[model samples]
Target: QYNCEKRQEVKHISARIINGNEALPKHWPWVVAIYDSNDTLVCGGALIHEEYVITAAHCFVNQDAHEFSVLLGTTLRTNSSQCNNTPKDCNIQKKTTRKTEVPSKEDEEYHKASETQVICVGVESICTPIQNTCCLFMKDIAVVKLKTKVNYTDYIQPIGLPKNCEDPPASSTSYSVGWGRIFEYYD
Candidate 1:
């Protein structure tokens, strides 16, 4: 079940959302990083349940369960300093692999067990409506089941889903979050 407290609003010069800015550990705790075997951030996911993640269906194209690991409790993609600064219950799973990616050789202290264990037990994609003409995209969502249950922390928890499938208010400020490619490099 969900077990995270509300994020405290802090006054800052930057806008509410911005690129390249490091996210606060407590803010949007349900947002998780989906990584590949080499520790590369492939996509971003939202924890909907202890053993379930909701992400873009395109991220799973040609990807396998064994090639992915979900990382939580940390904001830095490859570093665990954020977790190290947290209180108790900071544990990770340690497993050896052929060529795992470590943030840096000198930062061996952060080289701990992969904190999150994730496996795509099953994937359910939202079916698109049939169209006569070329269709770009439709219902581009998928739900992934985690093989191992996750230990909920202040940095890792599930988000509240709407009870009914209704469109949001037109003037609502929705957010798009991810650790994928950033606009900084595009220019």
Candidate 2:
């Protein structure tokens, strides 16, 4: 009688995009979203290799890989207002040397008012793990090599890794955004 799956996603919908040179573990350079088979959201991932996705490593356990879905190159979870296969009605001022002239203030403001028009962020490449690693949570780190490389586009590209493999300072602020109070944390 109701789309219960959709309702659940509304409560669990926490997805993100990683575009440009944003450093990760908080800010993703590409848009990453984890969803259910019916297109309900769950969490985000940082692309580590072609198909290798580095996530909490605790997110994939107790679930069938076939039941999970990942959508890349978008900030907002639901797919809406995508025209010409690009975002539509975006609310931000998008400027590039390629787009020489800026739109009028009214038009600019109107676009800014729209939530779907901004450009899509990109993740160079990411993948599914060989198996779900949750209970043990062996490594907080994870890598997902893609089944096939994602086609890159403007305003989106691969993120650069830390220059040194060494860990950052403890004072460094890192954040994790995901759905479910059922999450497992690691060092």
Candidate 3:
């Protein structure tokens, strides 16, 4: 059983944490980076299934599903020399020809490494509770279906969801993980 009790002191601050430490590789395997057509980091998402990701609906505001891609199996958002010496063990080749364009050769090399097998997949469709107004904060969740199914690896996995709607005990601890601006002044 997982222990849910609080183990750290509480510090209230801004939306993003200040002076946050970097997470170790594979620490949060379910986390994925969402990118726009221009290959810009737009938002972060959670892998819930082989071909599905969950993210905030607002991320899709004025965005085209076809222009979005999901990257999995890597902890570092930007390419690093650390991943350069590793073997390409991820099964990204099988889905390379789908609607979503694979990452450029440079991008592919940037995310490739033995410790992590990075793969990029295109967004096939997006579903939300509210069809017309997905930008609303209420029901802000959006489910994105990928054009190809991603093969799981040590660095790529789905997060387990709660089976029932039950509040946790008062003493339980909760955590939030995502990619956001590290410094408030810098965009």
Clashes of each: 0, 26, 1
Model 1 TM? 0.61
Clashing pairs in 3: 86-114
C-alpha root-mean-square deviation, each candidate: 7.7, 14.7, 8.7
**For candidate 1, which ten residues in a row score worst on lDDT?**
117-126
lDDT (C-alpha, whole model) for all candidates: 0.52, 0.39, 0.63
Model 1 clash pairs? none
Per-candidate TM-scores read: 0.61, 0.46, 0.68
Per-residue alpha-carbon lDDT of model 1 for 67-165, expressed as tens digits? 565666544454222233331222223333334333444434433432342222212222223334444246456676665666776556787666587
Candidate 2 segments whose C-alpha is farther than 4 A from its true place: 1-27, 79-140, 169-187
Ranking by TM-score: 3, 1, 2
Identify the candidate with maximal TM-score: 3
Better of 2 and 3 by TM-score: 3
